[model samples]
Target: MPLSTLNKEQLSAATAPIGNNLIIASAGTGKTSTIVGRIAHLLQTGIEPSKILLLTFTNKAAGEMLERVGRYFPAVVVNKIESGTFHAVSYRWLKQINKNVTLKQPTELKTLFRSIYEKRQFKRLNHDVEAFSSTYLYEQYNLYQNASLDGFDIWFIDKYPDHKPLIDIYMNIIDEYEDTKDRFGFVSFNDLLIKMRQSLLENRREMQEVLVDEYQDTNTLQSALIDSIQSNSLFCVGDYDQSIYAFNGANIQNIATFGKRYNDATVFTLSKNYRSTASILSLANRVIERNERIYPKKLEVTRVSKNYPPKLLIYKELFDQYQAIARNIKNSYTPSNDIAVIFRNNASADGVEASLRELGINCKRKGGNSFFEAKEVKFLLDVLSLIVNPKDMMAFIHIFEYGKGIGTAVAKEMFECFIHFGEGHLFTGMLSPRVFNLPKLNPTKNMQLGLFDDDTQIGSISRFAHLKLSEQIKSNPILKHPKLTDDGLIFFKNFYDFLKSIKNVKQPQTMIIKLINTPLYEGIVEMLSNQRAKLKSGEIDPDKK
Candidate 1:
């Protein structure tokens, strides 16, 4: 990207003396092109690649910028420029001092917190600690660190005074967790930011210039982390109107006050809109202008050609909305150019996808995994597969994975043993456990378990006919596998009871209501419901999976 190729505003901003520069770039205004031009101008001024640092929200953004820069400079020179997200760069900095530094994801940290929490004698506390789920408390601990620098106790007390009673215990638990992390050289995403700032406070400048992307969508904690950088120059590009992460702790004021924070900051507006027509920008401006303006800005169209005005359509039902969209797209869509159907939530996406399919239009998704691809869904499907045909070895092995201490290899071994005992079908072998009397296993224990030699192993084998499912599980030859454990396998026993109840029913449903009515499958439903109760804030079933 050459400086001459940039618009006048972009050129001025890119080549301006770099002290404290803030580029107020509106959406689709070639912000990336300005950044590219800026990079070229910096290199043209003979600045060393290592002295320039580019910080992006995602590693992919940094990689894209570098790849574009590489086209203008030698690969060796381009690669040397420090480029990465805050977490990525901080990890490298922290790793230099502690070779054992390790990063843990939110899921892993939550599990760790729960384990430590369960060991405490919270029952004795006047405040019912059990009232708050471990997941909710863990999310709050993270929320405090990510959103604010205030003391967790103060923050919790000020916002959720009712939770004040249990705050001390949570604070202690979190303190213990943090100490454990430090002792083990473990750091979460927020920890990397927190520790890196502390490190920078004690160090001299390493990079002379630091560039921050998506400044408007950064939280107070992140903004503080950026301010702690010991760089001589700061280049931040953001559009306050584009800020959309408030729910995740993003502060709109970070960008709004950038000029005031850096008194010498020079502001430039990238107003030329390359992506939208004048009609769209006009409506956009009208809608956003109604909001309070911390820093005034507007979008200007680049193209002089006339374009279609934006249309607003209303529908009475959600399904009707999707149907209308699908009908319109079906008539105008070109095979060479794909049409996009953007939805805010997965549930809306599902509706649009179904409508499109009904109209015989082929579409593919790009964001998250499909609904059927979830682990729980696949597990349920496996169970359904097993119910349809007990001889399904694959389904058997998959379901067996839920059994405590049973891996794929062990499950496979169990499957073979079941098939061998059943003589052909898995249910036949399970219904009759007397084959264990042949004795590679304990015969006296089988007698103790009330599992005896059947009248015949061919059909309707004898095994705990007089006992309940729980008793049968204890005596079942398959469940008593030498390699299997005694616990987690209990769920499988419940599933067996389910299979027996529905053995004669032609029509079966996976509905929770139906499952809860069964004495056997009700346990599975309850366990799944408990798992769902652990969902984090703003997490839906799709995102949870």
Candidate 2:
């Protein structure tokens, strides 16, 4: 059936303005289509695009919404419509409102200090590389970032003993960073929301309407930004079950308490599950029934099929679980099988990847480059790309090129090490250089090593390299002495052994199984366990299915 056949009452509850509006959209229920259509409907009804601000949680989502609306209403002007991730929109507003507000670039937070760690910066942070672990120092700076973005009270730092000193030091550096950014007219993602909230408060009368998408992901500051605008009408769309951004500080309470907070607020529930088979929907519903206080919605599937009842498996050990799943898929799995292994965390994908790869199955990670694009890994690769071919100027200068306060003596040492060792040299051997001459480095070479795939799969390569290092260490009697109590070395060695055994496996499920046995796999398991605990502890309810 065409979307137009769907009744308005079947749409986002935001269409009805009872003062404040809350929409609970279910999974695979055309949430984006409904949102875009709503925007088009609002426009057709004569709401000025400029007056109706549509806020989303991610830029990609905003872009998609804009494109969708354009398809339906070609003549509508969208340039003035406020549509973007909360940070992107906020940044644009903040740039206009606080012209003098300078921002610290992420590079400032990634600077190197060699007081203790003589190893690579990324490894130092993950393992014990520095005399004083930089994780504490890095997290100290991160607190300021988080506070600036989310407005956590300044006193919150006192709760952590290790962070207190960094907080004290931050009081001085933050001022300097802000001053420098202001002088240069720069802004960071955090600076955007901080400024937007300030702008909305100062110009409250000018604000007319605010429409928020994925309202469940709103943090304290984001919610405040909308509230401070004092808009006459507030419209929000999201389901509590889909609030998956707790790690980024999203407040579930924002969605959970809409009715109580807004006296005239009207709560609307979209009870239809328009995208799943009856069996599939039933399984999902049953699985989520364990969570409490979810809006009561039952799905009735329109289509009937003889497929086996939706399969849900519980395993005592994660390894055994992967083995069982892998065996089933290997016999006759196709790429278009539409198997989605949704995990609570990105790291959880590792084990699944290994298991699938072991079975020679073709599997692509579902998400974007977030896993491989972490600050630590990127910095390490930046250095490697430089040494591999200085002519690869893009990679050569990216290490210390962006961000503030990263060009310190320690940064220079890292750069020099990269220059001294040619591209093919071992990371451990190259980093052991006695002297790093930063000034003598020259980039006049015009050689090119061609292009390389720096995708998420490269992480598997890095893991393999670490595993090889562990084996080489074990072979040396002196280095294998009992004094070495670090389990990291042993785990990586075993991980490499496992990887070698399934080197030809090509399926995601098989690769996942092998990857899970790695030390990193355990870390991911711990994270999942923690999330489960939080769900059980009243912090989150998994039942909003």
lDDT score for candidate 2 against the true structure: 0.56
Q: Which stretches in model 2 have alpha-carbon errors above 4 Å?
A: 1-3, 11-14, 76-80, 95-108, 112-134, 137-154, 161-167, 205-207, 287-307, 314-323, 333-337, 340-358, 365-545
What is candidate 2's lDDT per residue for 1-545, written digit by digit as tens? 12464546455453564267777777766667667766766776687788778888778888887886776665448766787877777666676765565454455434432211222223212322222344554454454453345332354455454544334333433444455345446566666776666666677635456778888888766777777776778778888877777766677888888888888777777766667877788887786677666566654565566656765689998877776667777764555367766666665577777888898877778775685575444544554444444433234235433323332432343334443443333233233323223223222221121111221021122232334364344432222212122343443244335445555776656655565565544543454455565755567544531
Q: Report the error of model 1 at residue 296, Å.
A: 2.2
Most accurate candidate by lDDT? 1
Error of 2 at 382 (Å): 9.1
Each candidate's number of clashing pairs is 1, 29
In model 2, where is the ten-residue run with the lowest total lDDT? Answer: 449-458
How does model 1 fare in lDDT?
0.73
Query: What C-alpha lDDT, on a 0 to 100 scale, does residue 10 get in candidate 2?
Result: 57
lDDT of 1 by residue, 1-545 (tens): 47778889989888889699999998898888788888888899988989998989999999998888888899999988988998898898889877777787675467557644543445544454344667888888788887888898898778777776676666766776787577656689999989888888888556778888888888888888878887888888899888999888898988888878886889888888999888999999998899788777878888777798999899999999999999998888466146777798989999998998999988886689678766556567777777776755556666665555665545655666666676766776666654653223212222222223332132222433444456666566664454454443555566566666665666646433344575444444445555665566633454333
